[model samples]
Target: MSGIYIHVPFCLSKCYYCAFYSMPSLKRKDEYLESLRQEMVARKDYLHGMPVSTVYFGGGTPSLLTPEELKTILNLLHDHFPVEADAELTLEANPDTLSLEYLEALNAMGFNRLSIGIQSFFDDDLRYLGRRHDSRHARQCIDWARSAGFDNLSLDLIYGLPTSTADQWNRNLDLFFATGAPHLSAYALTLEPNSILTKRIAMGKAQPVEETAAVRDYGILCQRAAKEGFVHYEISNFCRPGFRSKHNSSYWFQTPYLGLGPAAHSFDGKERRWNAETLDGIRSEYEALTPENAYNEYVMLRLRTMWGLDLKYIRREMGDAFADHCERQAAPLVAQGRLSRTREFLYLTDPQMLFADGIAAALFY
Candidate 1:
């Protein structure tokens, strides 16, 4: 099954740590809508009639779009694409943009899933992260989502805040589980090079993320989520059984997907393409992956998930030399137990997955 991603590039304000392309002003929203529709029509055959199993409206703040606006986009998708009836349709939301009424409208429109950016349950953390919503609204939005009949709900939480403690991070996790959401995306607080957080730290106005504190936070997150019955399916994502994000999971397996709007990325079986990050109109750019680039990407993406990296598949798809390279490079880490090798696959062990990027790089050609 394939997927579709729509990038909404407008935001009320940028988060201190975010460097994603987003327009801070909504003055050109109508213009954006028209350009997005045109792009959709043009790319209708990009997937070549593949059954779309998931549709994600991710953004700057998709919830800011009115119910009618969302409906119009959905209508266009249904008209042009082979979107499955049971497709996992998701909208990424901000806690500040949600209300009971808004959530109810979204639910009624057949948007079956919601991913709310509730970065923290503590007001202090919210303030430090430059989030627009406070702690109360974060909890309230989840309750509203449930009350609105949303069963497939996901929440975003940021750990590794320099000002945070293990107990505080534990409390954030506790509050998240209490909400009964089926999925969670817990991310480490890495400062983007040119982001406000990075600048502040460089200017001595903010504390940097301490490695020891981050490790402790990661340990608590892994241990507690396991106890709570959440599966650490990907490096930064956890989900209960039957609730893994199908759209996101597709990217790992190299599934062809169509992405619309500015700053959106799309991938066919070989070439990956993206729209330039501009609000006026859509400008596309693409990269056709060479065999070596594709192999490196396959190694990078496959290793980040619970599925791990498979030697058999690699040997068949990328040939024996590449598979041998992978096996040889992975042997030392496997011996250290940072990675574990089963007969079929090499997996980044649970605790050692914190170094997933480094491990993947080590196996790269």
Candidate 2:
């Protein structure tokens, strides 16, 4: 089935490593919300009567919205789309922004899931990342959420910080596990171009990420999560059984989804489209995206997951000859133990996921 994603592009403060389309300024919140409402109406026909099984509010910080504003958007969604009765509605919140009352209201309004940004439980790491929340807020928010009756909670953590040692990372992981969260998404720290961290590194003001240390630390992450009974469902996601993110899984499973608001992306089964990142630059047009582009996207998304690509489905959907080309290209890597295949699917074997993008590119048409 289809899903809906709402891009709330406002943040209280810009993080050093973030490159997503977010602005710290709240000057256009009202205008942007209006535009978002209009965009939803415009794209109402995009899903073609398929029930929206999931609705996700993601962004710079979705918690930036006041409770009323958030409710208004949700109400509009329910009105416009045929939302399923048990739809998995998720809202991304910052630790410092969500109040107990606000969370109570959110639960009352039918948001069943919360994805909180609790990057690190250390003050120094918070400072390093330019995050607005402290260690205390991170700890308090989880307690607050649990008390608010939000059982389906997911948290985001980043490992491989420049100053984070193996022992320190373990402590962070220990604290994270202690929370008993059903879902977790942890990622390695990367310096992207044009981000504040990258600029500082170029100017010798900040240190570059150590590749060797990152790989070693990622190994630690895997071991700890597995010991805690969490499955490494995707490269950066861990969940206990029955707790995998249904919305995110839909994306990996190549299900149709329409994204609303600025910088959002939409994909029908065959094509894709992205809204402009800014209001002024956005043209009012929704057109069919290319099939070749869709094929590349399919490969990129599927290869990132643990399931990898299904050969039979690819052969049928992308042509048997192209499927053969993918296998031929991946043959050497499979022999090298960096990739593997069953009768139906081809996947990265542990070590290769470190260079998943490179390996996926090698096999791409």
Pick by lDDT: which candidate is best?
Answer: 1
RMSD of 1: 1.0
Candidate closest to the true structure, highest TM-score: 1
Give per-residue CA lDDT, model 2, range 132-152, as digits (tens): 889998988899899888999
> Candidate 2 regions off by >4 Å?
281-292
| TM-score, predicted candidate 2 vs. hidden true structure | 0.96
Clashing pairs in 2: none
* TM-score list, all predictions: 0.98, 0.96
Instruction: Return the lDDT, model 1, position 161.
Output: 94
